[model samples]
Target: MPGSAPLTTKDGRFGYEAAGDPASQPLLFLHGIGGAARAWRGQLDFFRDRYRTIAWDMPGYGGSAPLPDVSIAALAGALQDFLQAVGATNPVIVGHSIGGMIVQQWLAKNPRTAGAVVLAQTSPAFGKPDGDWQKSFIDARLGPLDRGETLVTLAPSLVNELVGDDPDASGMDLARDCMAAVPGATYRATMLALMGFDLRSALKAIAVPTLVLSGSKDNNAPAPMMAKMASYIPSATYVELEGVGHLANLERPLAFNAALDQFLKANVTATQVTA
Candidate 1:
């Protein structure tokens, strides 16, 4: 019931694409950088029939509006406003990649989350990257989306890189479409925001049943780095998806769904009791 409607918050407007049973529990989904809410289509189709699932497009990405000011904390505050607007007292928040970092920071201020999951990624503070990593926000990969290049011409190359070696041409194509649909200014601002933000300490402050899943082959957020994240979060459960890339949910939907199902089942009962 909560999944299908539009929820307007103090910060901006929020919406979710849902399907599952109306009577089931609620689950909020967050996507990665340059990703739209539809990125969770696999999970939406699988769990919406059993659980009330709602996925969001991050500010400045997908259908969501641009942020007043782009920063992890600002996004976190917007998330809080969204939850309150939607009247989600304690919905389980599930996020991927950069989304995971925002979720962690959001939970630091609002500890009322039923549970949270970090899928196929970790925070920006994982392994010590090169000194220029944080400073370099604009690059050739996102030149079109960040600058003035046309999406029709830029979609192919950028989409191929986003999909990596997923072996799912269809999924890759869909992601490419979403990326192409994104506005250049929105894409650029969001990437700039992600560059300097760090949530290392926020991991420990999160006081919810959390699941952290990493892809072994994820060059973006590798296993060793996520493993360290799992170690930091006192209540986090770590699981690595083998032979998968950054887009684990899309790359290996079966494995991704299985892991998600297990985490939900394990926490569903406890969450009900607490609620």
Candidate 2:
């Protein structure tokens, strides 16, 4: 509720929503492919009292400009710029789905930039681009857009598939609205960019405290896969939220926030005290 207002970076190239004390430790949220900054509204409100909570619209989503070349590295570079623009130092970064991929990419390049990280409903690898499974996965998502169906028309059903069976009505509406608002070109490019993603080798290099969260019912990033990913990270803790789906934050905000709080208290707060 606090970060309901839209905001832009000092240069106006990136758009986001912000709440809480600017001087406090920052909590930066990155949404999934189907989400924009508004997708983290619950998080911004929940964490506002203690942290400078901010949710960003990734490049080409919402009010942000499109990246000239969409890739994990490019998105990570954009994230670095966004962090500098916002004046966040060693922030707690939370990312979902493809957003999590971007987080991994950033950490690979700037290993010491974050105090902690939350990777929810995401994978360390997208699989080989030429693999049968990967090819089918890309085609299934792109086929709809290639057929001239706009995201506005396809969003309802697309979002429905990513949520749990007993999803909150308001959450469903929010997910649909955010997905519908994505530019078709951006969505297409993002899907293609994912084809080349492979961060399996970078997992062990994550030196900061990390939380790998998965929805038990998530089909996109299965619980077992996320668990394996956590095993590879030296300082990682894995959490599985039962009855939730790919849209963990939206599907079950309380559970999602609780896991995040636990990580913050154990890792972030203690780090602050030691510093």
Candidate 3:
């Protein structure tokens, strides 16, 4: 990591572990729910020399302080503040799953982004929970955790579907640990905020270069949904990684990184060519 430091903002202080060249373009990573900045270890390791790679624990997760306010907009604001606190201006953001939705919401409130990579995010509004899946997800995850169920014990079962099948034993444990570390209230608040979010209308308004990556077998945020989101964004490029679920970046890091590197290079080059 080029610079490892703690970030302090008006809302709270955040710990960010960074790796890469200080002079390179900054790339900010936002992990999914139950995930911390460390979730981007693979990415940071790969891109460090070429780009300034930094990932931080969001408020109420990992090393950051708890945030009682859990609204999507509030989360977005906190992210924005964190970015400023860390001195990343016009950064390229890569977000996975719930983190992806947070990026969308972040852009909605403040669209001055350099670029974005949205991976396997659910719809802005998860829409009305269908069948028992929604309620079941809530009951199994949010409800128990809120009431004092062991977060570590309860997190894996709740997000098992999001993780691809055939995850290595070590990878599975990492996922569980990340989820467990998140506070119960934060988890519940995030889920509730996700339930009512509908960002379809806001998509077309985004003007930055964007990439939407989908996991071919993701039940949590299916390919069709990512496609729908792509259609709404005039500048968005959509790609589906085969044989992976929601966590494509984690499940298939090499392929995902290759695609990402290509997209970012092409986009940055085109911008320079046009400029």
Q: What's each prediction's clash count? A: 2, 0, 4
Query: Tens digit of lDDT per residue, candidate 1, span 49-93?
Result: 656677787777655677788877888887887666655555777
User: Of the pair 2 and 3, which is ahead by TM-score?
Assistant: 2
TM-score of each: 0.85, 0.96, 0.86
Pairs with steric clashes in candidate 3: 1-19, 124-197, 125-197, 125-198
Q: What is the TM-score of candidate 2?
A: 0.96
Q: Kindly report which residue stretches of model 2 are placed more than 4 angstroms away from their true locations once superposed.
A: 1-3, 270-275
Residues 82-154, model 2: lDDT tens digits: 9998888878999899999999999999898798999989999998889999999989998998898999999
Model 3 over residues 133-231: C-alpha lDDT tens digits?
667766665566557677777767855767665654655666777777877767767777666567888888988888888877888788887888889
Best-first order by TM-score: 2, 3, 1
Q: Candidate 2, clashing residue pairs?
A: none
Residue 1 accuracy (lDDT) in model 2: 39
Candidate 1 Cα deviation (angstroms), residue 45: 1.8
Q: Give the TM-score of candidate 3.
A: 0.86
